[model samples]
Target: MFSKSKINDPVTGKETDAPRPSAPQAPASSGAPAPKGSDFKASAPKVKPPASTLSADLHVTGNMKTTGDIQVEGTVEGDIRAHLLTIGESATIKGEVIADDVVINGRIVGRVRGLKVRLTSTARVEGDIIHKTIAIESGAHFEGSVQRQDDPLNPGAKNPPSPKANPGS
Candidate 1:
């Protein structure tokens, strides 16, 4: 059943033919010569960075910061800053959450600041939300106000005057 390639049987001093697999050819549009059989492998597609995950049994008490995305299924007692943050259904966060995109499906007890914020049907939020765009699903429980801002991620932006203050008082 073997093909043309030959192998020497050391014990019998006989040559036997073996089937040889061919290398994969690269597309002509790649602009490169075909790789040798021993060195050829299929090109891999571009992959995004992996998201960091906090499992349901974990609990964190300090600030967390990352330029990449994060998926939290645990509890966190401090602030979080990331490019994208997903709070899982079992998660509970007690501090600020600042990200470019925030999807909350759990519980949060502090402020939320993001460019785009979404509270899923199972979400429970107890503090203010500052976002450029926000959506709260029908079954989400939010106990605080949501304020839109041009730059919700910037800490240096001026805060609105307190509603309780009277200009003459």
Candidate 2:
């Protein structure tokens, strides 16, 4: 058997008296090839996350403006202006909401004004709501007034059914 004192370095092409490390550090522009297993992990390309392809995905850190339909299931601390806005059950909004058609099944701590609005049983609105048409379910809780847009034209007409207030209050 060859003695340990006589070892060959494939990179330097010389027999060294001492045992060298596993891999050699070659100069960048040198024609010398790299070790198979050592280069893969060090020069591997980083895997990137896939891009989003949704029509409306609001991840706003500041004020947001849109003219199309939107579904908010994340936290939005700024005002939202959209044509049709749907606040999912997991959403939390702390700003004003303006939309032509609004549906809320989440928590909102700001004023919501729309032409037509529907508050689902899971909705919790702390601020007032101003709308032309409104609908509420059996378990809905709202602390606000309901005034129809037609009421302004015909002031003497009877008021519509008012929204029920919080039962525990």
Candidate 3:
């Protein structure tokens, strides 16, 4: 009484015998069993993290080059090469500022070459400031021109105010 090794039931054309592969595979997380020599290198090799150092409320969207040190409290439209730039007080720059050390407490419309510039009275500049050392803290709202960029052999000797008059005329 041992009949087994020839089964066939193509939807009831019936004929059976032959089935045994010791079926049991359900544990590799529910579909079981497969772990005895997977060379498990003690788990710890899944790293991907290195792109964070833009603090001061950061809201930049394009064109920003840094060599180290950047602090701007939101709003940037493009063009900012940093080596040390800090314009926080709800910062807002529209473009162009090559830094070496700049500190303005908000609002710049463009053009500011720094070597050392500080305009903090809730500053609001509208362009043009080539610095070598400048500080305006009397309710600052400067409209440009404060050049004394360390005398490059006297480039027209410190006489600013004539880009078309009105610098205390």
Candidate 4:
């Protein structure tokens, strides 16, 4: 009997065990030769992962950064950077926030920088906000100046005025 082994393929989502190939065959006189074993595999498109969440019982004391999304229901004492950040009604953040999208429903004690920023009715912000676009609900309590920029997430960038798409467009 020939040898066999299992290979978990992510593209096919299967665990397959096929018999190993026999001894090597004579090389073909082609520019590129065929592989000796089973070598064909498909590439799958990457899927976006679920947002990471910090529960209300958690309290973080250092900076947090991620390319993915985050839902915070706890307290954070340092800066946070993410692709998308959601602050729950019971959450509290004590440092700067930089993200592509920011949805605030709780309290923030520092500056907020985002491409799009939304302050819900439960939001309480005490620092300036730098965003490409912003929306504040009627009941939101905000004690901060708001500024618009083409790129607000880049802390060190001396942002110049960038043309924004008109609402009608």
TM-score of 1: 0.68
Residue 158 accuracy (lDDT) in model 1: 57
| Better-scoring candidate (TM-score), 1 or 2 | 1
Cα lDDT of model 4 by residue, 98-168, tens digit: 99999999999999999999999999999999999999999999998998888798877766543574545
lDDT of 4 at 146: 95
- How displaced is residue 137 in candidate 2, in Å? 1.2
TM-score of 4: 0.71
Off by over 4 Å in 3: 1-67, 75-82, 86-113, 116-142, 151-169
What is the Cα-based TM-score of model 2? 0.53
Q: For model 3, what is the alpha-carbon lDDT of residue 80? A: 82
Give per-residue CA lDDT, model 3, range 77-107, as digits (tens): 8878777788877889888777777889999
- Model 4 weakest lDDT span, ten residues long: 20-29
Candidate 1, residue 65: CA error in Å?
0.2
Q: Which stretches of candidate 2 lie over 4 Å from their true place?
A: 1-59, 150-169
lDDT score, candidate 4: 0.87
lDDT of model 3 at residue 119? 89
Residues 1-169, model 2: lDDT tens digits: 2224224434565545333432233333233555766543434476643422122245566667776777788778888877788888878888988788889988888888788889999998878777778888667767756666633222245555455655454
Off by over 4 Å in 4: 1-42, 161-169
Which model is ahead, 2 or 4, in terms of TM-score?
A: 4
lDDT: which candidate is best?
1
